[model samples]
Every structure is written in structure tokens, then in C-alpha cells.
Target: MGSLFEELEAREATARKRVEALEAEVAEVSGRLSAAREGLERLRIARETVAEVLAEMTPEKPGVAVDTDRSSAVDSVASAYAGAERHVIGVLTVPNWQPGMGAEVLPRVYRDILEVVTDARGPVRAKQIVPRIGLPAEAGKIEGTRSKLKRLVERGWLDEDTPGMFTPARRRGGASPNSR
Candidate 1:
């Protein structure tokens, strides 16, 4: 009986040691996992910063000189593309039945629209703008949005570099046409 009691004591000691070792291993693994997560977060932030810098560094189309008067328009376009990448798309809303109001009102709406487009990260279509600005979805069906976008291009608030690809003017001074 004494020998049996001794054996049981030895077994309990071994089991306790095993539990302690397992606890230590668990703590080490948890620390490693936390470190890895922190590293991943840092990488994600770095990637986003790099992407924004690259986008800003990219130049507009070659052989097309952007008008100096359209500097605000160009800035708006770049801002929009960057904003879109960050997932903050806004709409340009105008009061109903106020088209004939005044030049002041017109500039306000244009500024609002420009703000939305400039802050977006990608090319925003007229259809998307209507919904974002709190206008009826049918605004796209009407000729109004289309005409407004065209006017924006004419006024140098937006630039239609290609048939469907609209970008801001190249007045903010990042890359030159020769570099693109």
C-alpha cells in the first residue's frame, strides 16, 4: 500500500507539470497571434497610403493640355477618385424647381456636384450622381442629368478625357502629360 501511494503521488506530479507546460505553450501562441495581427494591420495601412500616392502621381492623357481656368475642376476629379477608393461617395443635391433662380444658386449646385465627383475614387456616371444627390432615380431617364454633365464638361468643372471616362482637369500639378 505504501508503494502504491508513492506511485500515485509521482503520477500526479507529472500531470501537474504537463498542465503547466501546456499553459505556457498557449500563452506563447497567443502572443505570436497578436503580433501577427498587428503586423497585418500595419501592412494594410501602408498599402492604402502607397495606393493614394500612386494615384496622385499618375498623369493625365498625353498631348491634351488642360486649361488653367479649369484647375478647380481638375482638382475635384482627382479628389473624387481618391474619395471613391476610400468608399465615401457623395451626391450633388439641388432644390426642386430652382433652375431659373440666379447665378449664385447655379454656382452652389455646381460646387456641390464638383465636390461629389472630385471626392470619388472612380468615374461616376450621371445615374449614380442622381441617386447620391437625393434626386429621383428617374433623373437618369430624363435628359437633365445628361445635359448637366455635359455642361459641367463645357464649363471646365469636369473633363471627359474619353467617351465615357471623365476625369478632373490636370491643374493640381502632380504628373506632366509627357510622363503619362
Candidate 2:
């Protein structure tokens, strides 16, 4: 009976030591998990702070004035279509006129006209472009808008499906023919 009692005491001691070691391991793992979670939370907060700061800052201005001019041309064309009593049948082709000479003389007007034309459903004729693109009424006398459309077609901005009918080149994935 005395030996049996001693054996029971030794077994209890062994069990207690194992339980203590397991408890220590559990505590170490729990500490590591908590530290990792805190690090993740800090990173999330940093990202949100950066986003908020950027939102508070003023947006970057356009690099070139020519881009604004092209945008204005697009606006003018849209406005013209909006006010027209006639259903918009086609796009307008503005003359290749730049305000100044030099490297600034990019044919942006053709691209702008193509953008507006492609936004429409039907073919756009040259006569329709004069008033819409902010061109002078006298533009009608300058070999007519037909010649301007032909010029655009030659540049690949406008496609002449027939003699007088014109359409914009098909665009895909936010890219246009002249975007590159």
C-alpha cells in the first residue's frame, strides 16, 4: 500500500510538469499572434492615412495646354450636338489649325473630332463639323468641310466608308489610334 501511494504521487508530479510546459508554449504562441496582428493593424492604418492625404491634396494639373484645347474641342462638339434641332447624323472635321507654329502644331483637332464622331451612332458629314468645332462660318468657303473630312480620313482618324460617309476608327480597351 505504501509503494502504491508513492507511485500515485510520482505520476501526479509528472503530469503537473507536462501541463506547465504546455501552458508556457501556449503563452509564447499567443504573444506572437498578438504582435503580428498589431503589425497588420498598423500597416492598414498607414495605408488609409496616405489615401486621405492624397485626397486632401489638389489634383495634378494637365502637363500641356494642347490637351486642354483638345478637351475644349470635344466639349464644343458635344454642345453643338446637344443644341441641334436635327438628330446628330455624323461627326465634324475641323481644319488642322494650331494657335502657334513649331512643335505645338500637332493635329489634335482631328483626334478631337474623331472622339466626338465615334461617340455618335450614325455617320457625320463635313458640313456638320464647321459650326460645332468652333470654326468660323467662312470655313464653308475653304474647300468645304468635305475636304477636311478627307484629310482626317487620310490621317486614319476618320474612316471614309463611302465617298461622303465618315466614321471614327474603332476604339478598344481605353486606347485610341493616336493615344500612343
Candidate 3:
């Protein structure tokens, strides 16, 4: 009877030791998981910041580099965010036209507007362009088209000779074909 009691005590001691070991392992694994999550979060933030900076960049000079100030800032930011996972989101905006650049860079709607203006026999009105671009002939649509036309003109992608009249911008050597 004494031997049976001693055996029960020994088994209880072994079970307690096993439970303690498992608890320590669980704590260690939880700490590792928390560190991994923090690292992943840092990486995500870095990737988003980089995407924004890249989206804001403009193709200024052909062979020459531009925006040295911005470039340096990007470099510092990139180094700080190194080892992050790759996930990117960007916003597209109308870019100021540069020589040797093509219309491909423009967003779809802007390209459509340019195409309509370019195909027109002469200067076109926003109202005329609105329907041609497949928009309803409504006041709101016309106004929106006009705003885009003005933006194109401001970006040097189009020329506005008269009020509410839009045409393709003239080249350096000669006037736009529609201008004549």
C-alpha cells in the first residue's frame, strides 16, 4: 500500500513538470509571433509610402535627372523601410506634358478628350466634345468636359484660343493643323 502511494506521487510530479515546460514554450512562441506582426506592419507602411512617392514623380527631363531633393528624400525613406513586403497602391493624376512624351501617359478620359479635339476639323466647344466622347449632352457633362479641356490646355497638351474653344497644342516648328 505504501509503494502504491509513492508511485502516485511520482506520476503527479512528472505531469506538473510537463505542463510547466509546455507553458514556457507557449510564451516563447507568442513573443515570436508578436515580433513578426510588428515587422510585417512596418513593411506594409513602407511599401505604401514608396508607392505614393513614385506616383507623384514626373518625367521632367529625358536624359537628365530631375527632383534631386525628392529623390534624396525617397532614398532616406526607402532605407528606413527596407525589408518590407511588396504591396503597392497608387493614384493617377494628369501629368504636365513634356516634349517627346506621348499621349499614352494620359488617363483614359483625358486621352479620349484629346482624341476628340484632335479629330475635330477645327477648334471644338466643350458641349460639342462632350457628346463626341460618349457623354450625355447635359449641362453637367459639358461643364466637366470643359474643366478637363482647361486642364489639358494648362498642361500644354491642348491650346485654347477663344473662350470655350479647344484645340491641340501647336508644335515648336509650326502651328497646330487645326489652328490653320
Best by lDDT: 3
TM per candidate comes to 0.34, 0.33, 0.48
Tens-digit per-residue lDDT, 1-180, candidate 2: 999999999999999999999999999999999999989978875754443232222214221111224455344444544764543211222223322322223246545555557776788766666556666656432234566466566544566776777787544544334322
lDDT tens readout by residue for model 3, 1-180: 999999999999999999999999999999999999989978875754454355444546221122335455445445545775632222324556665778998878889999999999999999999888898898866886887787688767899889888888986654333222
Candidate 3 residue-wise lDDT at 75: 53
Give a tens-digit lDDT track for model 1, residues 4-36: 999999999999999999999999999999999
> Which residue ranges in model 2 land beyond 4 Å of their true spot?
60-180
Task: Judging by lDDT, tell me the better candidate of 1 and 3.
Answer: 3
Q: Please give the range of 10 consecutive residues that has the lowest summed lDDT in model 3.
A: 61-70
Mark the regions of model 1 whose C-alpha exceeds 4 Å error after superposition: 1-106, 139-142, 172-180
Cα RMSD to the true fold for all candidates:
18.0, 22.0, 15.4
Top candidate (TM-score): 3
Report the candidate with higher TM-score, 2 versus 3: 3
In model 3, pairs of residues that clash are none
